[model samples]
Target: MTLPRFRPRGWVAATKAAQRRHQAEAAGGPRGPAPRSQRAALYVHWPYCEKRCSYCNFNKYIPRGVDEAAVRSCLVTEAQTLLRLSGVRRVESVFFGGGTPSLASPHTVAAVLEAVAQATHLPTDAEVTLEANPTSSPGTRLAAFGTAGVNRLSIGLQSLDDAELRLLGRTHSASDALRTLAEARHLFPGRVSVDLMLGLPAQQVGPWLGQLQELLRHCDDHISLYQLSLERGTALFAQVHQGALPAPDPELAAEMYQKGRAVLQEAGFRQYEVSNFARKGALSTHNWNYWQCGQYLGVGPGAHGRFLPQGTRGHTREARIQTLEPDNWMKEVKLFGHGTRKRVPLGELELLEEVLAMGLRTDLGITHQHWEEFEPQLTLWDVFGTSKEVKELLEQGLLLLDHRGLRCSWEGLAVLDSLLLTLLPQLQEAWQQRTRALVPGG
Candidate 1:
């Protein structure tokens, strides 16, 4: 199969105004009574890995001397509770993420999926993804998992280099990763995704680019290329601190990222988001919802969720996080019928900040229509229109703003951290003013 090459030559300021206007007009269409749609996704976390990687920081535990049956039961029960609370009739996507969801018994995965379908109206075509470790022999049982309800598979193949995989404390060999990917593709066809990480201890741009090129030969359409961040609590962090392992250089990592972006573009993959690339309709719907600031329900250990309450008046969103410990989560679920350890109602300012932060991470940016969906009283321009910093960023060619909304250019995304430092304060001040006026006492 031949793939088309994409050139980023015309993404300039001269055309941005037109693009922004078109996006805005397209977003604000007929305001008719719509069918009941959830406009949300579901995340079920299975926090157990066969062998924990050194660079990992996500909540995960080793499956040893643990009551596997009870843990599985808790996951199913929590999923049911979330479905009831959500009151969503149609769910767009369901993601099974984890330490290694594939490591769980196929029967258990099927049982939880069955419960989810029964509780909520999960259409047959909804994107159901299961995250798996490449070493977990998932290909051998891909048929069963597919029969159970999973339509997509995301494999955590951090690095294709055997030496680097060893340094990253991966349990699978390079050959094992490749074989498993090939088998999964053969079984599941075009519904497989592979993850690759750059900025390893001693990774070079040349080698990283070659690895990406080789990986595409076995992958379907989706690829998640992430920068390696050494979190504070991870084993790799301690090793780097103690001089046992060398840390990745920022400049070299940036070079790797740029090179990989060009290579993927040439391979017919579009960089829809900062770290994600897909060809045509192969985008990960589950993750796309999160990036677009859409609502989702998360259950299981250490999982987090954000949603607008069913009967809330204002745009005050609620953030929910379940207990991190498996035993504690199960106990809480048994006692209270749910495992939510903390549920905080996010204020308007907090919600705006979140929408801006998450939306800017994607290529589409945030539109006025999207903002008004949550808070009809205010638009993004009402807040950032008069800010000198926003104007300066636009003049500097870092931001694209028209009658529709604001979005970062490719250049802006490169320095998003520093750009946010300048852009967020103005919006925050506006939000503060709006809140103060809403409160009655002077």
Candidate 2:
């Protein structure tokens, strides 16, 4: 099922005006004290790749060669500028995500790390992660990257099947990926994670299980398993649309997910979040911050960051989205001294929806303490009880409410998009009414 796009949906200016009043009320009224700033995570996007994959949808560029020094310098400048803008001094983690961060020189990665260290008090025990493809480089270069201060490696080992690798347009074979995985494991030990794609056309459960078994033998502690999505404008999507390639079957995909979850569980991996499994104490800290709605700074072309922008009285939630095109982003950063193309302040209602949406994606789910940070006056019952659909879901045991707060049952997770669709409209209506009530003249 498709996820709901969390944007405005025909809500008139009245809604916007009401939301503004709601924010005011939240700041000084019964909503209690404003949330204290937390240590923000840092994201450095490396947008270049040697070759674009067929099924990929992220903002990435396949260029001949990038200006390593220029890009490195820009990343530092952008990160420092964001830190200053957000007044966020503490950094808990640094992640180098990308088209393929491995394409950049180790010196470039080191320079970025050094810049982060200089700009903020990056803890000595902070989790530093880098994304790399199997064919990024030889084991020596990967070892060099490890030496360059990257403690965690998120390798793009899309599949263990050579034929599947070809179909996915990946540059590396199964052998290459395995070799890199071994080398990375040797260097980083239990700090490496691998990404696995499921639900490919013509995929069989038996073979898929075999693939997982093979991966578990070499992987450190984490594995991100996701169903293949046919995103629009991607080569694979176009091919499926034109009937050149068959689209993934939903039934087959569900079967794959269930089996994979069971397999991972048996292998001593815990499902920390949907599509992500980890051993005890091995969760991805940077991503956990995202799920918990903690602040983060994204510095690079097409990157996105969310944080609390300082206000006269308190802090307000704001999002920063950078330019998509690499050259355009560089030009903007040069002209404006930063690459942010859009800045949006989320209203209380928007924040509530976001907190719920993202929080429910994890097994731990959202608690009262979590909700009160953004909307102290609000309660889970206030949001979920307004809808008959949610009430029905609760009665049917699809949703659970306990001392730990609201969370989806295993069944609810299976049809999460459907559940979200049922609740979102009701949530919007309730929030709209609440906002209007907060308005001065309402």
Candidate 3:
């Protein structure tokens, strides 16, 4: 379940095209009206961390010493400005994510949350979540955040095995993760999720199962189990390529995925989506909104967002994307409202790609008619899929077509990407046709 080395032709082209489009858009280039949604999600990033984990590829900065006050002020400033731009006062959810959101002092976390509440009509029961790492004593801090409107916590505990943790270059020991989780469970008494990494450079199924068993003992509301993808430009990637780290065996990793799901299901934690499992009604609202193509705004250094204006079709814009460095971010925001350099329009093809890629990982299935909506209906029936492939897949228990959309059931997900690839040519050719029609005299 590592990220594929095979980038789709469309994704590569879109990546470069998007960069160009973003530059022009930033300068107020021509664009169509954007699609609308009633309630939008918000993401506030905390870039400061006590240490830089080798495997991390996110926008993170290490502070020589804690500077909770400076970080807090920046967070508040970003939130206040974003709320003013949102227009509609009501917010559905707010997720505090990044280097270590828990590093901020409880009082600091509270003030940022408070400013958000003051500027926006956050629902009385809004789902507010703060991401925490196991190294910190976040239990004592949750009460302040709760009082300030935070109701959930997403803890990053990448592994539970001492050996694996060391290999992953994490500072927290297995005991530290376990103790902190226990304390957090006791303190918050709110929804808690623990993240785990699978298929590490040196990973084994026995340890993975033991970790899952231990994780379930706390009765966490959710679990995010991700395959260790060697992201390009990350330290891990360099190690693997330089022969300092070994590749994750594919077949062994597949076996782990199968067994891991079985173990979680036996413990009553259902696999709601790929990479995420939870008790009923405990799916991450912030993340779920992403897969559903819901509108969202991201603030702070190295954050990204997707926004659909107020009333248009197939139009979404990337807002205020920033640098990954804190010093640069501070300089940028101190001058511009966050002087961002990368904010591109995510086109319909990218949107559909996101849906297809994400939906296949969930119990949710891809609709048979997705080709019609995603690409073009005229030649879709002949191009990507035949009525037979759809019928056969449904008959074989490999897919489900429902009112919501097409979904890959638990069994179908094993071959989800492969099945979609079968129809890629049809979808691509149809997309090319439409592109030509739109750009006449080509």
Please tell me which predicted candidate would have the highest lDDT against the true structure.
2
Ten contiguous residues minimizing lDDT sum, candidate 2: 1-10
lDDT of 1 by residue, 324-422 (tens): 988889998887767998888888778778888888888788888887765688778788787888999999998988766778887787677888898
In model 1, the runs with Cα more than 4 Å from the true position are 1-39, 309-315, 436-442
Clashing pairs in 3: 364-407, 365-406, 365-407, 365-408, 366-406, 366-407, 367-406
The lDDT of each candidate is 0.78, 0.80, 0.68
Q: Identify the runs in model 2 with alpha carbons over 4 angstroms from their true place.
A: 1-38, 312-315, 385-387, 439-442
- Look at candidate 2 and give me any clashing residue pairs: none
Tens digits of per-residue lDDT, candidate 2, 1-442, equal 1111112221232233334433443554332222347469999999988788999999998876577667877887788778887777678888999988887766666666666666655665678899988887578777667666678999999899999999889999999999999998899888888999999977888898889999988888999998998899888899889998788888988888888888888988878788799996788999999989888888999999998765423336788899889888888777776799998887767777888888888888889788888787767778775567788988998788667778888777767777788776776887777878999987
lDDT of 3 by residue, 1-442 (tens): 2111112332333344334423433555333433344357888888877777777877886656644556556767866765555553556788988877776655555565556655654555668888987776445455545544567888888888888787777879988888887876776564888898888886878878888888787756788888888888777788888999888777777888889888888878868787788886788877877766666777777888776444444554444576767777767766765535576767776666675676567675455554344445443344434456566777888776655556676777767777686445445566677778789695
Better of 1 and 3 by lDDT: 1
Could you give the candidate ranking by lDDT, starting with the highest? 2, 1, 3
Per-candidate clash tally = 0, 0, 7
